[model samples]
Target: MDESANKMNKFDVLGSMNLRTKTLLAIGLSAFILIVVVLVSFFIDPTSITTDWSIMNQPPSLEHLFGTDWMGRDMFTRTIKGLGLSVQIGFFASILSSIIAVALAFLSSFNKYLDSFVSWLIDVFLSIPHILLIILISIALGGGAFGVLVGVAFTHWTSLARVLRAEIKRIKTSEFVTISERLGKSKFWIARKQILPLVISQVIVGTILIFPHAIMHEASVTFLGFGLSPHEPAIGIILSESMKYLATGNWWLALFPGLALLILVLLFDIAGENIKKMLDPASAND
Candidate 1:
């Protein structure tokens, strides 16, 4: 009876947490899951996922939870490895894209002519379909992990750049920033010291939000045969390979990996949205 009462008290405390606290907890949990996936993939035995003809096309069971592919590769292991690779790619791509956004945002803050040109450039990039641009850039760079990374990084920065540019424009009009300019502070100095700090939360939220898109695009491009190499244990490659066997009622081949990918993407999306909510002044009290 005492133990039950204590458990209820714990639940009550959790229930009492405000939205901001809950958002932080959600972000932390999401980050923890992603880290665990990456680490598990890093440490898993290669032989666990390697093909074994005798076990080919086995369905899910105790010995093989996610079943085996047509090549007798453990779908569970492949899915985990694929997810880890996708997460790594997305992580790096998001960071690179954020850096690009910051640089362009700052560049646009210098003068009216530069700002106009930068805004125009942002609009031009936005005008193109992201998938088409990514595919073209990936092909031009000789399609592989590096190509995909570059393509995603370059294409994902426009929205973030536009956001940061608007924030910088607003910050420039603030009293503190105007005072800094009158005191003979250089444009770079003011931007670095003043505007950058203010817009950092936006940058972080933007990067997190871009992560799912990066993973999905990487998978899409690879599935279409323009991203990662077929030899790689990427989610896209796995899904692409599964397509051949899918018509034969080998449902597990595509089902588990695709579902896992969807879940992973949703996790990042939830984390990003929660983080954005926590950072938003308008939603602070809620």
Candidate 2:
């Protein structure tokens, strides 16, 4: 009886935590699931993704789950591998973009002149259609993984930069920061010790928020034939190839890969939103 009562008390305590903590827990679990998928892909053999003419266009069955593509590749393995690769690219792109945002945001907060210039730059990028800019940049760089990385990295920074800029401006007027300045602390010293720490959480949340957009944009550019090469088993390429077979009644070709990509994107989206809410004091009670 005592052990059961203790277990119930633990559950009661968990139930009493603020909404932010509950959201954080959900985000952690979602992230863990994604990580497992990425890790599992590493152990799957490369040959499994190669063409096998004997299995061509086979529907989903016990022998080949998710069906076999026209090229006889296992759609299940391909989808997992493609989604894993997308996640990797998205992770790197998000980090690169976040770094750019942090650098510009710090520089912009330095003075009114720099602030106006950075704001103008952000406006310039924002004015251009996102997909168009991505296509232009990817083509300029010769349309490969490198081009996609550069395009995604450069284009995704504006919103996060703006967020960081607002946060830094607010922190700049705080009493402790003002006191530190009067006490002869160098600007760099104060920033390193105080400002950066305060902004780190926002930076982290911003990076997480940027991830799904990066993945989607990368997939979009690839689908439009301006991103990754055809040889790669990217989700975009899978979906693109599937279109040719769709009219012939091989719906599983497009269905499974598309659904997998959607689910992966949605997982990241949910995690990002939850992290954002958890990090926001205004949402603490929600």
Candidate 3:
């Protein structure tokens, strides 16, 4: 009986270690892929995407990995460049959105009046059609990367803010919070030392969750002619331009970039999910 118990314990430890390793691997792989894509985009030459009439509209071949576009520019380079721009936009927008969410959430917990107003504002934003609101915001801001950033940052915060508000409300009712209040701790002190630490995990997860949406929305608005300029080699621009060539059997134009965007989004989503699981002790083993 003792020997069997010892064997079972050893097996359990090995299984636990394996599970931890798999979790780390999943997150690391996703992060590594994304980092590589971003780095490639950042380091690639802008002139490499310039038109080269000699190689125009060539299908995927050994000489050209993703083929040449109508402009004869290397599609692979353009795709990477566009994705890199999108990643930058998405990263900044998500960070901005997370900041807004965390700020508003904490503010909403300060007073009933602020809470009511913030709640109503969140509802107003949420009730609008997402894309329409984004377009309007983008157009209002002059229709460029800045507009897309502002649109996404402003629009994406509602859900995360609502969640943080609820978490803060719950935290306020806890004994420690009550004791802190009784101990003459200022609201700022309590917030900085207590509420912030407790809700940080949620903030992180929320930020990660917002990233994929930011990228997709940025691409969508750009595609519809309401975001980035046509001169820019944005993923949206690539896709929009590719539409004209699809009927001519030039399928590679859209396919490769579209797949690249899809893969990037999937990787971000997987990374977010893995991080969330890692942060949650209850689900960490799973």
TM-score of each: 0.94, 0.90, 0.93
Off by over 4 Å in 1: 1-11, 45-48
Clashing residue pairs in candidate 2 (N, C-alpha, C atoms within 3 angstroms): none
In model 3, the Cα lDDT at residue 6 comes to: 100
TM-score of 2: 0.90
Report RMSD for candidate 1.
2.0
| Candidate 3 clashing pairs, residues 3+ apart or interchain | none
Task: Score candidate 1 by TM-score against the native.
Answer: 0.94
Deviation in angstroms for 277 in model 3? 0.4
Model 1 local distance difference test score: 0.93
- Comparison by lDDT, 1 against 2, better one: 1
Clash number for each model: 0, 0, 0
lDDT string, candidate 1, 77-138, tens digits: 98999999999899999999999999999999999999999899999999998889999999
**Higher-ranked by lDDT: 2 or 3:** 3
Once fitted onto the true fold, the runs of candidate 3 whose alpha carbons sit more than 4 angstroms away are 1-17
Off by over 4 Å in 2: 1-21, 282-286
TM-score of 3: 0.93
